[model samples]
Target: MDLVSTSREALRIGAVSYLNSKPLVHGLTALEGAQVRFDLPSRLADDLSAGRLDVALVPIVEYLRHPEYQLLSSACVACWGPVLSVKLYFRTPPEEVQRLALDEGSRTSAALAQILLAQLHDVRPQLVQLPIGDSIDDVEADAVLLIGDRAMQTSDDQFAEVWDLGDRWCRWTELPFVFAAWVARPDLPVHASQLADVFDSVRDRGVAAIESIVAAEAANLGLEPALVRDYLTRYLHFTLAKREQLGVELFAKHCRELGLVEASRSSLEHSS
Candidate 1:
């Protein structure tokens, strides 16, 4: 179907509001016929599943539960190494983590933490869901999983061992880990190619205007602009390519092996 003829109604777009996500969604609202709403990654995934969002920047693991959804091309929140965000803060070694306080904001990161522990440490810790914005200080857990802005706030003084999941995945699998990607529902009327083009264009513009983005985000998050710039430029990867797709598949395989998802067990199919 022709993209122009697909739909004239406003498209409901789900976006992650984190500073790390700004690049992919920058100027997205400027696109014609698009209505953008921002929320946490996990909420976005729920909205996508519940039909509240036509498309969403959702966790990669969300796709395994709904393989019928189409993954948009050339846009992702990924990292080749050392994402500097999405971290596991532990007072003990990875293998000795007895109780874990998990951030409910991102299930993908939570799953990644589990996958890493199981594969690398052979330990299965008890999981406790913790609310966002509140510190894990009150939670009685040996380790805590934090993502997005909170993860960036972590320092060596706070934890005996801080594991950057992106760096760990890269070192362990030698593949870029895709944290999130734009996914469209099977029945959405929008044109996939047109949507992909819109997202890619937004990403390019966002990266080009990194200085302004850095300044704004730094002020908003109370972080140094230089740090923000380094994070955006050095850590986060926006492109979803062949290698990234393979990475997603590998992640799915791990998820399945650990019984994290059921629907993907037979299909093993993912949108490229």
Candidate 2:
């Protein structure tokens, strides 16, 4: 068994490589027979699909995109009303906003934003894919959707105002926002216990020791440590309950109606 474990090499697990995700994977050092990998959620999804990872913290919709994928643990890298992180910045009074830039790190948030645009409030902003490191002014459009660490790092003083998508979704639907999640493939390796142990380490070290994470990660991103600490502690959550689950389902239904996803299969249903 020891030889088999040694032969396993590194697990090549995938993560966002962002401040928000560091806590979820902070305990990877303690997991035996497993090595963690980090990248954007899109890259994580692509790698996981291509068999580069045993599991990953993929965007929620990516899991829905391939429903055959399984969730190994209940813990998620999510939040209730992630004010500074998952926000949609608008220059056009929210109603007349025309062109919108879509954050490449996002899949579920982009979809949820569209759902709100079409269903909750009639919006038709031209969604443009803006890659990371692309230069664009906040005044370019009436609205632009931003996600992940970059969104959190963007100060309100830099923009006219920021709308927390998670917070707005809560006010509109009264539920917690389900963002990124951990995923496992259908043919999980026999060393699954080690996988569970890895996640156990993440939940214990990452969630429990958030201040250190916020301090370190905020500094790396050139953001105020205090602001990052406030967001991580007051906004983000790791558990999925009845309402968040329902919100997932609701978003899935809306996506199906918009023809964004194949109707034969539903991607919003996040089941472990």
Candidate 3:
């Protein structure tokens, strides 16, 4: 089934509104014959699924779940270590956790939190949703997962244990972790190569303008420019290369083992 229009129309691009995603979407609005929309990571996934978006930066888990999606570009939101934006706070010991509350804004990080807990401690706790705009205080659970800007601002003083999911994954697997990627639905009106180039070009420009991006975004996110700069440069990795691809494959394997995604289908489609 064709998911996109047959006629040439403005490409509908969706991106996350978080600070971590700024580098990937910088100057994207200037693309010829393209329209870009900013949304939550999870919402972007939904929009892509419903054919409302031609391509979107969606959670890696979302891509793994849908066999029809193709990796549209090398641009991705990844982390080598200590991402400082995706965190798990444990009120009780990890192994003893009986209930885990997941942030409504996350799909990939929620799965990662479960996978890490099960792999490291052999625990599979019951899951609960921490609705958008709600905090850990509003959720009754042994542990809570938080992502994006909110996770960075959260304090760890009250938690028994705080885990930066990216750091934990790297320490456990010795590989980088890919959280989200630019994915496109099958059978688009545009050539895959052409669209991929547009996405990659914007990503390169965005990465090169990180300093200016930090300068513009810091005050808006209520973060100091230094911290934002370090977060972008030190904690986050914007390109999805060989190591990052390995990370995605490994994550898909874990998701399969844990029954988080369909086990019978190939989970990724790399761009040619």
Candidate 4:
């Protein structure tokens, strides 16, 4: 049996649209069995939960919300510390902040920010939900959390502090952050694992071709190719490992405290 390409059906897979995610999609080419569908995590989660996808690379928060998904082996889009890609720019101190405007690309970051501010900082900041194209400056929110590619190029004006959610989480909880994960619906047929293999392969290819990915996608995001390359190879991580495990547990705990989910670590684990 080959590790790649066994099934003929296309496996609907959701992928992030940022360069940090380049490696994951790049690695899918080695798969011989599944066809993948790529989209922003928000739409992917909606579709996946609606029974449109078999397996997907989705936001970690999505996995947190849906206990019905099983995580794939040895793969995640995580970062040990400061993830420059997921940043929260503020116009006031963390304590003084009253409201937050969220980027629409990923709702997970918004949830994380609200919970972190409340639990860790003991501040009940109001959350103002806004779509992706909404200008952070125009919003009356004291802070704005932006994620993925659009966030990477955000101008640093009108904020007193810049916080990377990943870094803040690590500092507060001393664990790495699993921003995204490869997950499958619970009781998914054995054939669905074909999509899992596709995700793994493309992720490897993406990692190997970071230079090319940055060269191609950076300009569109208004960041230099070299900077994007550094962020991919140095700032971002592509594995689901030790620190990532800690991140998942910690994140799960935080989510629970925020009333986002009630699932425990033991219950969240899906044997692959």
Candidate 5:
């Protein structure tokens, strides 16, 4: 069926357009009763909260922000260490940094940056939101937070210090960090378990098609295919297993301590 026809009857699923997400949603459109659409990570959270999307790959922090939403699948956009994609470029040392320009496409990364800066570095910079494509020169910040494609494309030498939040979190807590997860709204038109099965199947297919996904996305993002493949296979952790669940709980604990989210501890656990 065409998009218009699918939009009305199928479950609306929000897909991220970043290269990191390409593998997760590969061949997802081929799934029946599910209509996939693309949007930024932050927008997906908004759409899901507003009831525009039945399910979405939303920022992990969004799940904490909205406790009513149920995690729909075992697949996630996660990382164990040094995720080259989520970076904080700083011209000044972490403690001296007083201002930060944030990527508008981020919600989880932005909040994670805050948590890290406050607790880890003892710094509380004023955050200013900027478009994802905006240049670092556009705002005079001591540090800048970039996520997704833009973060991947950035060079390390451009900044005095580059802090990968994933690496930092892993080193500090020795646990994987879940950046995004597939979550469904409280009241859905479709059954939650059925949605989970379809999404899990799609995730498996997507992971199996990694080579094709890397080749196609490399051309679009202007990156080397080998590097893209390594990043996908090595850096990006897509499974939400026991350790990943522990990561979510730890992250939620930090978020709660920072007063960033109102969710209870159990809300961080993925619902089967």
Candidate 6:
């Protein structure tokens, strides 16, 4: 069915509130027949699963967990290398880490940290929650995983070692890591293809308007515009092409092996 013609109620869309997601949602508010809400990535996943949202830009791990979810757009939050925004600060060596504090807002990064540690060092640390607004000082773990703006701003001087999960993943696997993607719940009132087009168009426009996004968001995050610009343009990758698809597949495979997510019922095929 054509959503614009048949649905009187606006499509409920959930998006991440982090700076990395701004480009994907830049023009979303102005789109007719859609209502956009911003929240933490994990919260968005929960909302989408509960039927509160028709679609969401959710963490890729969440998408892999839900077999019914459909890939709605090719636009995503990915990194080819050195994502400065998703980091792990280790107070102990990787092999000696006994406990890990995960950012409350993250699911993908948390899972990625575990996967990396387990794969490289054969260490599986006990997991702990690092509540939003809580710092490394508050968590009495061997390591802490932080994502989004806080990850970029937090000092690493107190830590024994730091790892940029994205950079490490790329160096280890030579593949781009997809942090988040636009996914729609099953049985949507609108055509999936149409919705995908809207999302892709919004992403293109947002990427083109990176300068404006930096100018508007940098001050709010207490970061320099130059840093924000480079973070968005240089460090982050938005398109989910062939190599990114391979990354998603590889990530899902590892997640399944680690039992982080169930065995895949279907492949993550994107709408063209």
Per-model CA lDDT versus the true structure: 0.85, 0.71, 0.89, 0.73, 0.85, 0.91
Q: Which candidate has the top score in TM-score?
A: 6
Tens-place lDDT digits, model 2, residues 183-271:
87876664555555557557767888988888788778888888788777777777666676777777667777876666324333334
TM-score of 6: 0.97
Residue ranges of candidate 6 with Cα displaced over 4 Å: 1-3
Error of 5 at 91 (Å): 1.3
Local error of candidate 1 at residue 167 (angstroms): 0.8
Q: Per-candidate TM vs. native?
A: 0.93, 0.86, 0.94, 0.89, 0.94, 0.97
lDDT of 1 by residue, 113-167 (tens): 9999999999789889889867868688888998999889767587889889999
Model 3 steric clash pairs = none
- Please, what are the lDDT tens digits per residue for candidate 3 over residues 179-254? 9999989956677777777778888889899999999989888889999999999999888888887888899899
Give me the displacement of residue 74 in model 4, in angstroms. 2.0
lDDT of 5 by residue, 130-230 (tens): 78667877878999998988888888887889999899989999999999989989977776777677777778888999989988989999999999999
User: How does residue 187 of candidate 3 score in lDDT?
Assistant: 58
Worst 10 residues of 5 by lDDT: 1-10
Clashes of each: 0, 1, 0, 9, 0, 0
lDDT of 4 at 121: 69
List CA RMSD, all candidates: 2.4, 3.1, 2.9, 2.6, 2.5, 1.5
lDDT score of residue 18 within candidate 6: 92
The ten-residue window of minimal lDDT in model 6 covers: 1-10
Those runs of model 2 whose alpha carbons end farther than 4 Å from true positions after fitting are: 1-9, 138-140, 157-161, 191-194, 263-272
